[model samples]
Target chain A: IEYVEEAVEAVDKDKWKGIAVYVDHIDGVIHPVTYELIGKARELAKKINHPVYAIMMGHHIGSQCEELLHYEVDKVFVYDKEELDRFKMEPYTKAFEDFVENIKPTAILMGATPVGRQLAPRLAARLKTGLTADCTILDINENTDLVQIRPAFGGNIMAQILTPNHRPQMATVRYKVMDAPERKDAAQGEIIRCNIDSKELASKVSVLDIIAKEKEQFIEASEVLVVAGRGIKKEEDLAMLKELAELLGGQIACTRPVMEAGWLEAKRQVGLSGRTVRPKLIITCGVSGSVQFTAGMNNSEQIIAINKDENAPIFKAAHYCLVGDLYDIIPNLISQIKAGKTVSA
Target chain B: MNILVCIKQVPDSNKVEVDPVTGVLKRNGVESKMNPYDLYAIETALRIKEKLGGSITALTMGPNQAAGVIREAFAMGVDHGVLISDRKFGGADVLATSYTISQGIKKSGTYDLILCGKQTTDGDTAQVGPEVAEWLGIPSLSNVSKVTELKAGSMVVEMDMTHEIEIAEIEYPCLLAVDKDIFIPRLPSFVKKQETKDREIRVITLADLEDREEKHYGLNGSPTQVQRIFPPEVNNHREVWNGEGSELTGRLLSKLKELKFA
Candidate 1:
């Protein structure tokens, strides 16, 4: 919620004659959210006879500016600085805080991913403005001038949050929620470079080091993830699952029930209370598809679920499924995957 | 340490349905409740209050009806409550909502820790808490699963995401968005429910806060706007199995094999 409000705070003042979208950050390359916010921003911008201007922030971020023009913006602000080459809080916030004070755009929007969440709030604070996060929708009301509509409460209530007293309405949108606008390869836009003093960087937290790892680090780090949950009907089921997990690769995992059952170590479990797993592929033969389990593995890219109920939510999110008894499914599935090669010969 | 918990009254997400033809929210009879995640946030604050010996104030903005959530907060043991409600505040978006709530916080004068839910389920927009920090000029942590460490002046927190955990410190006046695992909200008691309802529910408005009347809040200040609201599309890519017996199993197995699980 703080990040969402920060996105709005970044751009709450100024009667934008045209829609000007602030670029949250580009890895020097445009993030997917740039176009999505633009597509939505343009529609609202058009209603008020205003074109959209997209802003970009990064070190040497200017080199990456021209590509943004094609994203359908009237202008683009590229705030360049060495400190931003890697995302450090102090430098990145300085670059954004400077650009926002100058340009005074209509509504700043960025994806509500991890980076945006952290960056948006800090910038909003520096700018001293209002921000709305994770908005499902964005639009303009000519009479009220309110960029309107969003959900609140646990996705149950739809509230219209506004910053009537503030300017440069800022908001950070969740990715994949909004549609990307139509891309015109030939479309053009203006670009400018932004700078902030290095002395400004001297204060604030310093990043001694950054550890960026690929996705597979989770499963590889665990020696034995004793995953147990509702499916571990008996203490012996833990042995069966451990055996299957050992035969293939990786550790044992379970639903919350298994931990409650005292059948496995709390640290080894893989549900909500336990650790979230990103194994190369999780093969759960007995577990049901509860939202708790889904939240842990929805990002795994690949999942193999074995359950008696075909209608389980897990099956929809899984890459593979086996509809059979777990007692029967576990042993068979393990043997097949561990074979290394099929019985083609 | 004084903890300020930002809470919003939300309808139950699972029960929300769309008007089949009009593509609008069916708010006709939907009931609103404390956002499930915010419940944890309040509890975390109360727990912090219990451990650190401090005050936990509950703050929110909504219609007069939003007092129900406040009653629940009092039941759970928040030190005080403030509701930013007014006629000019209807149709406020998250941006406006934040300004109103942040004003409420500022009006109260002081706070140490700020607690909030990761995101509201309905809008699924998690912007208010961080935005409040921005407006308040404070440090923040989003989706915090635990308070790993705390001190007299600064503190460290553990942020939980899909597969990663971030440990960071938040100085006083910092914002933190907590997930359900932060701490389950105390179950409301039928006894306290009646008791707190009788307790004063502090209500403030634009007038009381001495807030700007240019309407910096309530829908007018929002920029990115929603053009429409309807049921989210159900993207189902199901392959129906019409064949029976061996044929069905054969097709299913082959499909699994094709998916690289053979």
Candidate 2:
């Protein structure tokens, strides 16, 4: 099991040219985070005068290249092959290695999804580069260095990182953190179909089968979220919260404690450890706001929190705060909504 | 079967503060504990060892005090423990940290499987496990939700790929970073804790690693550098309401209506 280290060599910074976005997709449909990264890349590219490129790897994905061009990408590299259909770590990393060898991107952005998190590290290690994960902010400096800002130590402190010497400064950002660029009516990018050798796409792990889980509404994409916190006394109390969530045409979410209690699924948890959600309206009930909990949903458009503790830290992040018991407030609010007393604007 | 579980000691609370002037973590008296996620990794290793009859060795990289986590692992039924510590390894980023750990793993001995928590509570990068696998040039899997089967030379696992769950089989000498709730981690036994209190925890330093290049060990080896550190900005302009439940509910409904959320 012994491993040998390779000698380090200096690389010319000018050899890397463009800012590339990893276009993540399943089947043929594109992930929304792809456009968001493209949007961010377009901004970074303008400052450095570098081209914005999108590298997509999947089978039967040639048609999606034109759609990517609408997002102001200068070029789209497609590695469409049968072996590349499903995301096996080895094949995906190999294809991306080939793309990097040819394109020499100055910076690479990827969605902080399961696939991206797994792929980014392996690729960065293989290429001997640096990668900051789940970055909240990305900016390019005068020297074309990517400034990666991310929350560290459970969202208490924000750290700004730099890959000054790496050829392609890489970063993985979570979904909904950045805005997806507006789509144009006409496509304005060149599609370069890359032909990767079949041998290069070989993988060590074999897929036995893929079982598609039932499609449930993801809390990350929800426009409105009714969040339950540690103040929730009992597991059965979630039913009342569910009623309010459905009445508001949103979904029910919970804090880490509630999720760990087995009252809600892991995907429904909102916090640093869970999903980062930016809903149009987020209501927190009985949640004493720890930085870990508020960091995920503070970006929400309108936030309302009801907690018994007047000095709950969540109040600092909320637009409207109510100092009261959730047991009394939630029931009253449910009744008020049922009576149709509130008028929609 | 031989198993090596990677673990770390992190501050007990996430409320750890950073010094405003020095940009250094103010960790004078902050009690540290084994990262909560690593408990899952330990539990997974314990279960596999329980069923297959193997020795479980817990490994961690930190100061000498980090051996406390290894002792905790021993109380949870780990057979051996090792700590890789050196002042030269300080300030290492994920790249250098993983490389250092990989070197320590090679020195410790070979294992059929290497297990790790999904990520550390402090770094929260979820990158070290796979990067260590890469440095070792072995196949790795993340977000492994379930272990379908374990064979003599291979194991089957179901990975949560966000959209779909894919079951894949990987051969021995690979790494799998297990997610939380893989199993309800059992608490350390008081008896075992008392028995293993004086157990030896072998410590390895930078000089012990074969790659003794100073530039390849710590901050010098890391490509990424932390430029600045600051407290997160907070928005404190909020309207606080205190009243009867009925009155507050009515006001909340009106506010929701004004915002078109009703």
lDDT of each: 0.66, 0.90
Write the residue-wise lDDT of candidate 2 on A61-177 in tens digits: 877877998899999999999999988888999999999999999999999998899999999999989999999999999788999999988788899999987888999998778
Model 2, docking class = acceptable
Q: Looking at model 1 chain A, which ten-residue stretch has the lowest summed lDDT? A: A1-10
- Winning model by DockQ: 2
| CA displacement after TM-score superposition, residue B122 of candidate 1 (Å) | 2.6
Candidate 1 wrong stretches, greater than 4 Å: A1-91, A101-109, A121-193, A199-345, B20-24, B161-163, B188-197, B212-214, B236-262
| Reproduced native contacts, each prediction | 0.16, 0.82
- For each candidate, give its TM-score against the true structure: 0.61, 0.80
Provide per-model DockQ scores.
0.14, 0.43
Q: Mind giving the per-residue lDDT tens digits that candidate 1 earns over A1-345?
A: 112222333332344455656565535756677677888888887777666777666666656678777777888877666666655555666776777667666567767777687777666655545567667777777732646555543444454556555555667777556667656759587776666777775323323323333333344354323245575567876776777556444567667777677876566656566677665456665677788777775655346666667786767776656565565555554555456345432
